[model samples]
Target: MKRNLLILITAAALLISGCATGPTVTRTASDEVIDLSGRWNDTDSRLTAEAMVSSMLSGGWLERFSTDEGRPPVVIVGSVRNKSSEHIDAETFIKDIERELINSGRVTFVAAGAARDELRDEREDQQSNATQSTAAALAAETGADYMMQGVITSQTDAIQGKRATLYKVDMELIGLENNQKVWIDTKEIKKLVEQKKNSW
Candidate 1:
């Protein structure tokens, strides 16, 4: 009976202590650089997209396509495969790439993937449900002249609580009509983290 009472007292004390020092929450700015776990993060994605797309736009393909096609080339983001072991969100990276492409003003950006299909569905619904003047015409979608696709790869090494990881983002822009690779670029980011000696 005495031992059972002691266990109950100890459990209650521990629970109370835990509640007294519970975790705190604080909000931070979106652009703040906070690397808590040394994983593939937003900063890496944004930087990679900015550098790679800038270089891609400056390539000879842009001038050649503009001259041959007599207009700014339309581009669409295809797929950004995350081959890294980490569970990185590829869509976020793809958005970053699309943003850079659109903001550059050097190329015409077109929608791709399911979003394109969603637009088509909406157009079809409009044609059936709305007036001819209000409905958007079918088969008017502008096809992309070039498609960008790529993969993300990573390597990690650790020794004595010290860990370093290197991520490589390789991307390529290909001519949609010819399936020819017009521009290819690779950007790399490395991070190092050390585990605290007293994990407790």
Candidate 2:
């Protein structure tokens, strides 16, 4: 009788342990689109970058600048302010845009903000320790003719188990020397999620 009781308890403990374990995890491709939380995601960033860059390149801004200067215009990516309800990493989106811009070869991109500061620090370090010819010169950094800035805003609505979210990203290009607004654009994304409530 005691042996049977011990066997029953062991089985029950094993079952409870199995139940307490969390859900399984599986690795997927980085580019695969997966929407588990209905929040802004990698797919949204990539799509926005592609759309914005495509529009910017095909528009009159590049041609006009190249016509006037006879060379590709230099551009710097500035702060992309996130005024959304959820915490969003703006750098990932900005880097995506920068990558597309650089790959296009129509615009020259220069490091800005923290990246520029880090580069300057590295140069300073090299000036002290590295060989003279290998050390980079100060004040020789490329100047950006245009600065890109933007803001992201979001709205969310929920009713029972249904939820909807809308995200809007607005961007602008300004001439650094003349302080003129040269180009502006906006991209938007919407998501709908339906969840079932536990009835127990």
Candidate 3:
């Protein structure tokens, strides 16, 4: 009986001590400070955009637009071919170009294939309903004067557990009416990563 009472008393004391200890608070590195030491996504995007802009300006596309006697340039983004092994969002890259072009206030963007298809279908349906006299007037018709397209290629080389990744993105703005190339740009990004073997 005495031993049972002592055990119970010890258990109660331990429980009380544990309760008084309260919840543990762990301290680690603050997430607010972003660590970009190894990551090059932001840098790569900026560099790619800058390179694209430089390529366009130096290629005389801007100069042509300014001097050539024609209507305002309306560029439509066409297919962006991805030749890389890994799946990538090519539309994001095209959108980046579109955004920069819009922000620059130099060019106009016509709806791409997807948007144009939807709009065409909508117009056809409206015309069938006969609510409007002509679909031409009912729909805003804007054919793309220039088509923007690109291709992304990737290369990998590994030796002795060290790997290198190279991505080359090339884009061009072609005159749709005359099939003439007006603007061309290419951006190359290379990265090296060391591989570590797992010991199990």
Rate residue 16 of model 2 by lDDT: 95
Ranked by TM-score, top first: 2, 1, 3
Please identify which of the two predictions, 1 or 2, would achieve the higher lDDT against the true structure: 1
106-184: candidate 3 lDDT, tens digit per residue? 6677778777789778877777775565554545687777888888888877777676778888988899989999878
Report the C-alpha lDDT of model 1 over 115-197, residue by residue, as the tens digit: 99899999999988999999999999898999999999999988777888999999999989899999999998999888967
- Model 2 is weakest, by summed lDDT over 10 consecutive residues, at 191-200
Best-performing candidate as measured by lDDT: 1
What's each prediction's TM-score? 0.87, 0.87, 0.69
Which structure is stronger by lDDT: 2 or 3? 2
* 1-200: candidate 2 lDDT, tens digit per residue: 99999999999999999889687999999889998888998999899989888877887888999999999999999999999999989999999999999999999999988989999999999999999999999889999999989999999988878888999999889999999988899999999888898111
Error of 1 at 3 (Å): 25
- Model 1: colliding residue pairs: none
Task: Score each candidate by Cα lDDT.
Answer: 0.92, 0.91, 0.72
Off by over 4 Å in 2: 1-22, 198-200
What pairs collide in candidate 3? none
